[model samples]
Target: MSDPGGRGDTFCGINPEALQGTINSLKRDAGRLRGSATGFKTRFDQLGIDTLPLTKLLHVASWADDQLPMLRRRHHLAVLIDKGADPVLHYPNCPDMIMVDDADVSADPPKVSDVPDGSDPKLNADWWGALTPGMRAELTFLYPDRIGALDGLPSTVRDEANRTALSKEKGQLNAKLNKLRKDLAATKAIPPSNVDDVGGAIGGDPAYELQNKIDAVQSKLSGIAAVEQGLAKGDHGGFPHAYLLGFDTHKLGHAIVSFGDPDTADDTVTYVPGLGSKLAGAEGDISRASALWQSSNQQAPNKHVASIYWLGYDAPQLAANSHGADVASESDANAGAPLLRRFTQGLTAARAVSSPVHTVVLGHSYGSLVTGRAAVHGKGKLADDLIFVGSPGVGVDRASDLHVDPSHVWAGANSHDPVPDLPGPDPFEDLGGNASSFGTNPASTAFGGHVFQADQDPSNSFSSVDLDAHSSYWDSHSESLDNLAKITVGDYGDVTEAPQIPSDVPTSPTLVGPGVL
Candidate 1:
């Protein structure tokens, strides 16, 4: 069956005829795929890197190769093979990954006076207890994409790993691109022996395959360059330096970078961005985060503040055929919730109890759903304060249902923003899955949270404030930004609360732009 919408392509891509053909091919190539997997394991063994997971993953990927694009299948194999083949591979010795136990920390020689009891023992302060300086430095040489994914590592270590990984990727891509360009130049420079040769050259065009290769190489290079430029544009100078928390240059891309050290700050805010958020446009989110950091510091002059622009989750995309409506879903949020939750726990655990860091988790647009899922379902304490601005709907019915205290929860939405009006369908009620299933709007009185002022430009009425208003919550000099700043520094009393929407007023949008941000 042909799918009118792109949803079928995005998820399983399961068509009966195509599925049958794919299954048949997989069965035919089973022996070859196993042989390839064995070769991968042998190579890993020769390189002295862990092979079990890498080999098994490759074997599994081979079975699905018939269903995916050839390039994607190749990439899948490359990544699986790269687990052990990467020059910077580090296989942790322990059979199972474990956080630094309290016993381990106490037994080690005193490292720092401010080391908090039961804090994430993997933090920089306690780095020595987990790994020696040599081993730590060695990790810098490994592939950051792999290292950054591992939990229970120090934030700074993760940062260094990611930076190194990016540098390595860029360097490799540049070298390949340069070689391709040289080959193209050589092919173009070749002189035709005769005039007929030039006219008939189309039959055996020397540059055809080379040109295709160059285009493919250039495309890959451009993607990495885009991400780098995004990071550069958002770079800030001074005390609160930027730290790359996570990065991956695969499909759709993802990144988690911070404007300051969450592990050491007295106050930290991890801002989760919403719809249309990808690594390509990460700079905009990072810039907003930097502005929030500045605003928070200015709001609370004495306190140290940090802000993290978290783009770890694969957000829903407004595909070519998709309408602006029905973009919110539970799957992406559910997939990313654990990552968000663990990041928060690591931040909290890395701090000194003597000066416990007060953390605020802020979500904008679809990001609110991600934050909600992580906080409600994730293990341990995720954050001290939770703030949702311009949310579609969090995946819960009430503030009480969220693990955090109802008082600590705060919600804000611009009067003109259409997202807040999305009363998503209940998945249980709608078996067809066409309707919105996200829970009650947290900003609504029925949901129960401290509603804060996120008023748009008064000149722009509810009808006038378009989808852009959804993203303007952090606009400088706006009441919304001020309240957000105050909240970031834990000045809850200073927040200018907005009244709940009256029952009679229309909640859904009367006007929406061509796209949803």
Candidate 2:
């Protein structure tokens, strides 16, 4: 068909009403062309097209097959399921809802759930492999909280889902606040005497209802703001492979984020935070992770590196007068160990079988203890290399006890770091009746691993910062961070040795100090 303006209104019997419509029509033609051996040549001859316009049309038609559909079928299926309709009954081959049956999501009285909670590794692995990106995205919007917890899913999917859920929730809160504001304005317009003194009001005391709703909205808004602020601090400019693994807007603000994809990267570094670590403190943690990422890339430009800031478990909170300050007890570490193991295992399972990724876990201070528990109690190889810095101890009497090779395990502590010399005795007893309370000290010669120099002490330098010795491993121009980067890029020979501390130094119960963010 041709328009009155003397322009062709159709391309090869396909209407060019709009850009998207034209694209879709061309896509159908491309599909037909692909199915027929000589369709391309035949169409070219019929259109008398041998020029660039024909080439551009052919390219667009061919490319349309690769692009995701604007109206995703899975999302439409989910919308149907949300209503009372039986989607499977109507469309038997609706691929997205394969795992869910009519009984699973039926809402008359919600039935027992079949959707995996991410606890079952085998089930989640299968689920992760079964779904396509579009299907996963739809599921994320449908069940953000559930899908975000699944370890096997890609980090990018989880991040997108969480962001979508956050926006939806914020919108709901805003709507509620707007309605309350209108109600309040209407109530205020009436004189106090006109309003029923007792129970004549429709929704009870308008003032009380309005104030209550306003308080709830404000409280939720504050929580959202806190999460947003933490997210802003960790914003990585959406660099390739950067992701938010977990997010929960609540007290203590639980969130887990990663600087790279551990599953597919050639080298992966997982950093666990120690004391005083909370979701609110993610900015600082992310800053350190970003530094490590940059350093590793600079160290080995050819290698793909992923540096993750893992706050998967709740770190010990610092309270002025609480027993939580004493992290010597293995309770928190033990509890966190299983989750850490699962996280590492997930990384291993998700990677390509032919291209194995080298995984490293770095634990600082109390996090050393957390990593220790995972290495000791957890099954399978949690990581290829484990680095503990400024560690008190990894709750064992010797490094040999760790599942990983003693050679693969490493320890680093600044010469002046008080952590290794902290007043602490081994809390647990060995079979030989020897006390090993806080576990085996990783930095000790008896632990049988290489000790590297962190050299983070600022006291000997012109700087007078006190915390420098404890948490300055990643300081700019520091030898410690350089060595860490070397280790990350598999350049072990260049790492510096740790300065030896005498064995006869006075020892006390290894007490945990409040950690910095």
Candidate 3:
């Protein structure tokens, strides 16, 4: 039989006292938790710094290993596990995890009037009550019972007990807050400010961008290892794709996605991204984030708008395929027609009869060709608005050849961008204009009957173009974005001023250049 409160050779090597000591020590620092050394194995699989330890515990309890990281889990597991493991290993090691000793704070005993409430009865306004809530509660509960007798108990004793509990609670709250502060300090998240209202504010603050990048890198740093594992297993379910598109690549890609939106009332915007675009930490993603911003502004309250990020296909690198509309894309036999067909089909599938969609198709570069041909044959059907930007060709050189209602057609070109300047789809002999049939004629006017929009800021971001126009059309200070926002809300009746962009980037080319292509 086991000894009762006695150590005996008869008992196995299990030292209950040592085990209790371990439990108590951990509790002292970690809020009375006797973390299981065995159970720790289960937590070890979480794969990332569970900064909010509670979040990890919640996930651990809620999911199986298969449910661990949601989407691309196997591929992203390593990152998740690393993130989860961090809080467990690091948080308990913190010196301020709990402070039973009164030495860490100001030496003066907190006078009830001069200082705050004891927050924990065991604390007696001492400097040490700044632990965790659990720590405070445990201290409050244990101290009074251990140190004194409650004989001939009075109502006063009960009142004193309640006060002690509150103090304990305060102490625990302090500890938790300290932990939060430390984490914020470690990540160095920028303090929120009103400065973002001005575009110039982004310049002096290198910390803003640096912190953003660091956070991004750290978030997905673990994901890379996860991706490798997924690739090996040929499973990408748990992996999260994160892209960090530079100013130049994004400059081009942003133009591409924006051009893909239909410019008419029944317009549909299908946004396709380039390499390195994801929901997290990708510059392209942030650039695209503006699309939502612009759209929300346009969609004020009640408006018909449909937008989608076609993340279905992996974008090719500029080196692999600089021109998106090249024959290489459509040469697959299903080529031009089928791809466009599917897109229109999706729009048809997603429409509401009451709000019958007027078709507006926007194609950037190669996408223009896709939309261009789709409009011409009615195979993909003519949309009310067709936008072509930085396009090599829409399988034709003339806009009139597209066969859509010419009134609804539009085109845009940056001052120096050479894409539209290219011979329109002359290479693809299967299409047309091999000799001189020439595709749709360039609408060949200055944003006439077209709403030309681009980066208004003079910032050195690669996504902007300068046509040397003095007009506020591309000016950062212009109300263009706001106007766009209102447009989305179906309020085109009373034409108001454009939305103002924060002024920072220049609105003209750095060097004096040709005004037109």
User: Which candidate has the top score in lDDT?
Assistant: 1
Candidate 1: list runs displaced more than 4 Å.
Answer: 1-128, 178-239, 324-326, 426-437, 459-465, 508-517
Ranking by TM-score: 2, 1, 3
Per-candidate local distance difference test: 0.67, 0.65, 0.35
Candidate 1 Cα lDDT to native? 0.67
TM-score of 2: 0.66
Residue-level lDDT of model 1, residues 1-517, one tens digit each, is: 2223443532212223344465566655765777777888889899998988866767586646644554233222223323321233222442121112222222323332322332342453355346433233333443455555544455676677787777787788789879987887886643464225445333356666676767666655565565565456434454376777778766667778777777678899999988778766777788788889878888997887888888888887787776666464578889888878867766755554467778899998788989889988745546888999988777887887778789989999787777676545553432321112376777777777889999865764556447777788988878899999999998988999998865445345534334453
Worst 10 residues of 3 by lDDT: 242-251
lDDT of 3: 0.35
lDDT of 2 at 45: 76
All-Cα superposition RMSD per candidate: 19.9, 14.9, 25.1
User: What is candidate 2's lDDT per residue for 1-517, written digit by digit as tens?
Assistant: 2232343552111111233354566567777755552565568778986655545655665676655243233234334333321222222233222222322222222112534777755567787677433344346656776667677666666677666666776788799899888887876654465467573433456676677779767766665665565456443564445576766655455566666666568898989878777765667776777788878887888888888877788777766765433665677788888888887776665564468777899998778888988988656667888898877677776777778888888888665555655544532322222223365557766678878888754545523224457777887768889888888877889888775443443222233345531
For residue 174, what is the lDDT in candidate 2? 90
Q: What is the TM-score of each candidate against the true structure?
A: 0.66, 0.66, 0.35
